[model samples]
Target chain A: MRFALDLIESFRMAIDAIRANKARGALTTLGIIIGIVAVVLTLTAANGLRDTFRQSFSAVGSDVIYVSQMPWIMMDDFFNYRNRPPIDLKQARELESKLQGRAIVNPYLGERRDAKYRSEIMEGVQIIGTTEKQLHMSSAVPATGRFLQPFDVTYKKQVCVIGSEIREALFGSANPLNQMVKLGRTEFRVIGVMEEQGGSFFGDGPNFDRQITIPISSFVKAYGGRHGRLNVDLAVKAPSSESMEMVEYMVIGEMRNIRKLRPTEDDDFAINKLDTLIDTFNNMMGVVLLVGLLVTSISLFVGGVGVMNIMFVSVTERTREIGLRKAVGARRSSILFQFLFESAFICLLGGLIGILLSAALTAVINATLMPASVSVLILVIAVVVSLTVGVVAGFVPAYRGARLDPIEALRYE
Target chain B: MAVIPEIKETTLSLNAIDKTYDMGVEQVHALRGVSLDICRNEYIAIMGASGSGKSTLMNIIGCLDSPSAGAYYLEGENVAAMSENQLSEIRNRQIGFVFQTFNLIARASIFHNVELPMIYGGIPRGERRRYAEEAITRVGLNDRIKHKPNELSGGQRQRVAIARALVFNPSIILADEPTGNLDSRTGGEIMGILDELHAAGQTIILVTHEEEIAQHASRVIRLKDGEVESDLRVDDTDACIAPSESLHLVGGATS
Candidate 1:
C-alpha cells in the first residue's frame, strides 16, 4: 500500500516537472519521435509487401505445380540450369497421358506482344498460348461468351480469349466477341473476355487480368516451334489439395522415365509450386525486415542517448529541490522513480505521435500505390519499444540523483 | 546554574557524539565528544560562531547525519546504529525541519508543500489533505494555501515552512537559523509562531548565531571550538545581561 502511494506521488511529481519545462521536455522527445516513425514505417511496409504477395500468388493456384526449365529462384550453377534441355510439347503430351486419371496437365507458353483492334493498340500485352485444359489450371474464368474448345487446338483455329484489361484497351464498351484483333501481326477473332483479377503491387508474379489466351497449335505456328525460342511449361493440378504431395511424386517419377534419366543422375527439370515462390518471398522479406529494424534501432539508440543527456541536465538543475524532498522524508527510491516516470512519459508521448504519423503515411500509400494498414500488434510493439528506451536512458541519471548526499545537495547554489 | 527540574522525562540523549570530516590532508573534527540531554517540550537554543559546530550538532539531532563515534537515542531508541532507510523513516515520522531559507519547493503550492511530509509518511490522501489544511490554518495561511512560495512574502513563506514542519506532529521541530533571511520585523513574526508552538508543548531545538534569536529560548547552550562552552537557564529578570558577562557567568556555572 505504501509503495503504491509512493508510485502515485512520483508520477505526479514527474508530470509537474515536465509541465514546468515544456519546451525542454518536447525537445528531449524529438529523437524518440523520429526513431518511432522509422520503426513503424518499416514494419508497415513489410506488412504491405506481404499482403501484396499473398494476393498475387493466390491466383497461381496453391494445388497446381509447374514443370519448368529452371527453378524460379536460382542460386548458383546458372550455366548448369541453362544447359538443361527444354520440356517440349511432346513431353507435355506424354506427361498428360501418363497422369490422365490422376491430375489435369496443361502446357502453355507466354510472351509480351502488342495487340491492336481498329486504331486502338495496347503495348506489352501478355499473350499466353495454351490448350483448352488451361482453363482448369487458372483462377480466372471467362465472364462473357465461351472459353477455347478442344476443336480450336485440333484445327489450329484463329479464335482468341482476351483478358479484361485487353478488352478495355482495344474495344472499350464495344462488343469484343466475334471481332478480329491483331496480335503480333497475326489476326484472330476474340471469342471471350476473362474476368478482372487485380495485379500484385510488387509485380513479382503474373497479372492474370492483363493476358490474352490463344490456341497452342496456332501459337506454335505463328510465334515459333517448340524448338524455337518459345519453351513449353506444363501446369499439373492435383485431384485434391490434400493429395498434392502424392501427385507431385507421381509426376516427378513419370517425367524421369520419359526423359530417360537414370537413378544416378539429377532430374534436369524443376518442379515449381506456389510454396516455393511463397518461401522465397518470405525469406527476402525477412532480410528486409531485419535490415530495416537494425537501421532504425540505431536512431532509437541515439534518441535514448539524447534523453539521457537531458535527464542529467534536469537532475543537476533540480539538485536543491531534490535535497528539499529528501529532507522532507522522500526515500531515494522515490526520487529515482520520479525521474524514470518523467522520461518514460515523454517517450510514450513521442510514440503516440509517431504512430499517428505512420498511420497517415500508410493511408497515403494505400491511396497512391499499394494496400497498407497499421495493425494493432504494430501499435503495441511501438509503445513497448518507446517505454523500454525511456527506462534505459533515464536509469543512469536517476541513479546519480538518488545517490546524492542530502547535505551537499541542499548547499548547492 | 538553574536546576533543570528533574530532567522531566528525557526525549533525546546524545552520549559523547563525535563527527569528523575527511579534508584530504587533515581531518576536521566537527564535533568533539559532544553530549547533552533534551527533555519533552524544551525550547532550547544552540549558539556558536561560524566554525563552532552547532550546525553539525543540529544535523545529528535532526537525524540528517549519523555520528562517527558514540550513540544517539531518541525516546531511548539507538539511532546511531539504524540503517539509512530506517533513519529516513525516523526523520519522516519523528523530526520536522524548518530552514532559514524556508526550503519550500518553489513550484509547489503552499498546500502541496505542507502535505509533502505526510505524503512520504504514506498517509491516505483524504487524511493527508485534512492534516495539511489544519496545519496551514494553524499558521494562519488558510487563504494562501493555493499560492506558490514565490508569490508570498518572506514572513508568509516562513509560516508555510512552519506549517510543513508541524503537519507531521513530529517529536521535535528542528529550526536551523529559521529567521536568518527575514528582516527584523518579519523575523519577529516568524519567531512568534515558533513561540506559540513551544507554548503548545511542541519540543523545538533552535540553532542560531544571533544573540537576540538565542534569547527567545528558555535554555541556551553555547559552543566554542567543537565542545560545549556554556549551558545556562535564563531567568525573566536576567534576560538583558551583557553578552560577555553572561558568558562569564554561564562559564563559571557550567565549570
Candidate 2:
C-alpha cells in the first residue's frame, strides 16, 4: 500500500512537471509520433495492397489455369524450353472434347496486337481471340450487343466485340453495331462493345478497355501469317474450390496422355493457376512490408533516443524532487514506475495521435481511391512496440532518479 | 556541568562516528568522533564555521548518510546498520528537515510543499490534503497555500519550509541554517517559530554559524575544525539572548 501511494505521488509530480513544460514535452514526443505514423500508415497500405492483389488475381476465378509459353518469374527457363512445340488450335479443341462434360475447357489465344480505328491507332491491345465458351467460363458479360456464338466460331466469322475504349475511338457516338472495324490488315464487323472489365492481375495501365476480341478460328485464319500454327491457351473452370486441384491434375493427366509422354517424362505445357499470381503478389507484399517495418523500426529507435535524452534531462531537473520522494516513503520501484509511466504516457499518446493521423489519411485516400484494410494485428503491434520503447528508454533515468541520495539532494541548493 | 534530565526514549543519538572522503589519496575527514544525545523535547543548536563539518553532522543526524564507523540511533533503534529503506522510513516518520535555502520545489504550491512529507509518509491523498492544510495554517500561510514558492517572500518561503517540516509531526525537526538566507527581521521571525516549536515540546537541532541563532536554543554545541569546541547550557536559562556587546551600553537599535 505504501509503495502504491509512493508511485501515485511520483506520477502526480511527474504529470505536473510535464504539464508545466508543455512545449518541451510536445517537442520531445514529436519524434515518437512521426515514427509511429510512418509505421502504421505504411503497414496499413501494404495490407491493402496485398488484399487488392488477391482480389484482382482471383477476379479470373480459382479453377481457371493460365496457359503461357514461359513461367511468370521463371521466364528465363522459357528460353531453354523454346525447343518444345507450341500447342495449336486443334490441340485445344481436342483437349476440350477429351474433358467431355466434367470440366469446361475453352481454347484461348491472346496477342499484343495493334488496332487501327481510322485516324486514331492504339498499339499493344491485348487481342484475346477466344471462343464464346471461354468468355462464359470467366463470368464475363459484354456491355453491348452479343458475345461470339458457337456458330460464329465454327463458321470462322470475322465479327469482333470491341472494348468500350475501342468503340469510342472507332465510331465516336455512332452506333458500332454491324460497323466494320479494321484490326491490323483485316476488316471485322463490330458485333458488340464490352462493358468495363474494371481490374486485372496487371493494372489496366495501357487500357484493357481499348482492345478487341475475335473468334480463335478467325484469329488463326487472319493473323496466322508467319506463325502458321496458333499457340492456343486452355482455361478450365472447375465447379468449386474443392474440385479445383483435382480438375487441374486431371487436365494435366489428360494433356500428358494426349502428348503421349511417359511417366518418367515431364508434361510439355505449363498450367499456371490463380494461386501463382496470388503467390507472386504475396511475396512482393512481404518484401514491401519487411522494408516498411525496417524503416519504421529505425524511426522508433530515433524516437526512443529522443525519449532517453528527454528523460535524462527530466531526471536532472527533478533531482531535488527525486530526493524529496526518496526521503519520503518512496521505494525504488515506485520511482522507477513513475518515470516509466511518464515515458509510456508520452509514447502512447504519440502512438494514439499518429494512429488518428494515419487513419485520417487512410480515410481520405480510401475516399479518392481503393479502401486500405488496416490490420488489427499491426495496430496492436505498433502500440505495444511504442510503449515498450518508452519503458526501455525510461529505465536508466528512472533508476538514476530513484537511487539519488535523499540528504544530498535536500542539501542541493 | 550538571547532568540534564535524560529522555531515555532516545529521539536521536550517535556514538563514536567518523566520516572520511578520499580525494586522490588524500583522506579528508568530514566528521571525527562525533557523539551526541538528543531527547524528545530538546532544542539545541550546532554552531560551526566553513568546512567545520556542520553539514556532515546534520546529514548524519537527519539519517541522510551513515558514518564510516560507529552507530546511530533514532528513537532507540540502531539506524547506522539499517538500509536506505530504513533510513528513509525514519526520515519520514521520525525527522523533519528545514533547509537554509528553503529548497522549496520551485513550481509547487505552498500546500503541496507541505504535503510532501505526508506524501512520503504514505498518507492517502484525502488525509494529506487535511494535514497539509493544517500545516499551512500553523505557519499562518493558510491564505497563501495556493501560492508557489517563487510567489512568496523569503520569510514566507521559510515559513512554508517550516510548515513542510512540521506537517509530518516528526518528533525531531532538523534545521540546517534555516534562517541563514533571511533578513535580520525575517530571520528573527523564523527564530520565533523555532522557539515556539521547541516550547511546544518538539526536539529541534538548529545548524548555523551565527551565535545569535544559537542563542535561541536552551543548549548549544559549537564546532571548529570538524570537532566540538564547546557544549554548554544557555546562561540564566534564557531562550532569547541579546547581542554579546551589551545592547544597553552600546545603545544598539532595537525593535
Candidate 3:
C-alpha cells in the first residue's frame, strides 16, 4: 500500500511537473514520439509487405510442389546452373509415365486471350489450358460448373471454363454453363465457371478471376504456336509427404532422359515448394525489419538524450524539493526511485501513444489499403522496445537527483 | 548527530562537540567544545551575528552535516559514528525542518508541498493525502491547500512549510532562519505558530540572528565567532518587546 501510494505521488508530481513546463516536456517527448512512430510505422509496413507476398504467391498451395521454369527459393546451385534450358512438355509427360501410379501428374498451357458474351466483354483475360490435376495445386476452385475433363480435350474440342469474374462481366444474372462465348476470334461453349478469387494476389501477372480455360490440345491448335515449343507448367503430386524427395528425384532423372542429356551434361528444370517460398520471403522480411529498426533507433537515442537533458534541468529547478524531501526523512533510495519513475513514466506514455496511433493507422490500412497483414507479434515487439528506451534514459538524472545533499540543495538559490 | 544532549527516552543530545572547516590552507573553526541538551517539548533558539557560525552549527545539529569531532546522541543512541544513510534516516524520521525561504515547491499546491515529505517517507497513498490535509489544516491554510506556493502570502507559505515539517510527527522541529524571508509583521505570525507547537510539547530548535526571534524560546543560546558566548533560560521572552503585538497572528498572546 505504501509503495503504491508513493508511486502514485511520484506520477502525480511527474505529470504536474510536465504540465507546469508544457513546452519543455512536449519538445522533449517529441523525440520519443518520432522514435516510437518510426518503430510502429516500420513494423506496420513490414507486416503489410509480408502480407502482400503471402497473398502474391496465392497460387502456390501449402502442401503442393509447383515445378516450373524456376525454383521457389533461389539457391546458389540454381544461380550457378543458370545456363540450364527450360524444361519441355515431353519431359513433363515422360515424368508422368515413369511415376505412373505413384503420382498425380497434370500439365498446363497458358494462352493470353480476350473474350465477350452477349455484348459483355473482359479484356486481357488468359485462356488457360490444363488438366483437372492443376486445380488441386492452386487455391482456386470452381463456383458452379464442373472443371474440364479428359473427354473435353480427347478430340481437341473447343469447350472452355470461364472464371467467375468473366462470368459476372459477360452474364450478369444468368448461369454461364452451356453459354457460348467468343474466345479471341474463336467461339467456344462455357462448360464451367470458377468462384470469385479475392484480391487477384498474383497481382498483374495472371488474374484467374479474369481468366477462361480451354483444353491443352485445343489451345495448341487454336493459338497455332510451335507445337514443340509449349508454354506449359507441370504440377506433379507426390504419393505422400514422405515421397516428396523420391518424386523429385524420379522427375529429375525422367527429365534428363527425355531431354536426351549426356551423362556429363546438366539438365534444366525449376522445382518450387510452397514452404520454401514462405521461408525465403520471411527471411527477407526479417532482414528488412532488422534494418528498419536499426535506423529508427536513432530517433530513440535522441529521445533518450532529450530525457537526460530535461531531467537534468528538472533536477536543478526542483533542488529545494529534493532538499525538503531529504529533510523530511526520505531515504536516498526513495529519492532515486521517485525520479526514475518520473522519467520512465514520461517515455512510456509517449511510447504507448505512438503505438496506439500506429495501430490505428495499420487498422485503416488493413481495412482499406492492402490485402496483406501486420501481426500482433510485431506490435508487441515495438512496444517493448519503446519501454526499454524510456527506462534506460531515466537512470542518470534519477541518480544525480538522489545523490544531492539536503543542506546544499535547500540552500540553493 | 544533534547538538542537544537527549534525555532518557527523549530526543536529541550533544556532548562537547567541535566542528572546523579547512579553507584550503586556512583552518576556520566553526564550533569549539560546545555542549547543549534538549528534551521533548522544549522550545529553544540560538542567536548569533553574521560570522558567528550559527548556520554551520545548525547544519550539524540537524544531521545535514557531520561534526569534525563530537559525541552526539539522538534519542539515547550515539550518532557521532552513524553512517550517512543512518543520519538521513534519523533526519527524516526524528527531525522536521523549516528553512528561511519557505522553500515550498513553487509550482506545487500547498497540499502537494505538504505531501512531498510524506511521499519521501513512503506513506500509503490514501493516508498520505489524509495526513497532508490534516497538516495543512493544522497550519490554518486548509482553505489554501490547493493554492500554489507562488500564489501564497509569505506567512501562508511558511505555514505550509511548517505543516510539511509537522506532517511526519518528527521528534523535533528545526527552524533555520525561518522568519528571515518575511516582513516583521509576517515573521511574528510564523513565530506564533512555532510557539504553539512548542507549547504542545513539540521540541523545537530555532536558529536566528535576530534577538527578538531568539527571545521567543524557553532558552536562548548565543554564539560569537565559533564558540558559545552565553547560554541561559528565559520565560515569556518575546514579551520583552510589546511592539510585536501587531505581528502576532491567531491566538498567541501579544508579544
Best by TM-score: 1
TM-score of chain A of each: 0.92, 0.90, 0.83
Candidate 3 regions exceeding 4 Å error are: A72-94, A97-103, A110-128, A164-190, A199-206, A210-212, A219-232, A238-268, A352-356, A363-368, A372-386, B1-10, B15-36, B124-151, B233-255
Relative to the true structure, candidate 1 reaches a TM of 0.91
Tell how far residue B113 is off in model 3, in angstroms.
3.6
Task: Report interface Cα RMSD per prediction.
Answer: 1.0, 1.9, 2.3
Candidate 1 lDDT tens digits, A63-132? 9999998988787689999999888889999999999899999999887789999999999788888999
lDDT of 2 at A217: 81
Please report the candidate that would top DockQ against the real structure.
Answer: 1
Residue B170, candidate 1: how far off, in angstroms?
0.9
Better of 2 and 3 by DockQ: 3
Order the candidate numbers by TM-score, best to worst: 1, 2, 3
**Alpha carbon RMSD to native, model 2:** 6.2
Comparing 1 with 3 on TM-score, the higher-scoring candidate is 1
Which residue pairs in candidate 2 have backbone atoms (N, alpha carbon, C) closer than 3 angstroms, thus clashing?
A143-A195, A329-B120
Q: lDDT tens string, model 2, B1-255?
A: 112344234466677789998889799999888777665677788988889988888888888888888878777789889888777788888888888777788878888888877766778889999988988887889999888999989999999989988888987899988888999999999999988888787889999889888889877777777776666656423322322322232232222
lDDT of 1 at A408: 82
Kindly report which residue stretches of model 2 are placed more than 4 angstroms away from their true locations once superposed. Answer: A51-58, A89-102, A116-120, A135-139, A199-208, A296-304, A341-389, A392-395, A411-413, B1-8, B222-255
lDDT digits (tens) for residues A1-413 of candidate 2: 57767777767876887888889889878888898889888888887777666655543777776655545556446567676668876677778898888888888787777776667677777787888886746645788899999988899999999888777766789888987767778888989888775565466532446668899888888887656666777888877868988888888888887777899997678888778867877888889889988998899999989998999988887777777666555566767787888888788878888887888888887788676855788689779977998899888988888787777666564
Q: Report, to 2 decimal places, the DockQ of model 1.
A: 0.57
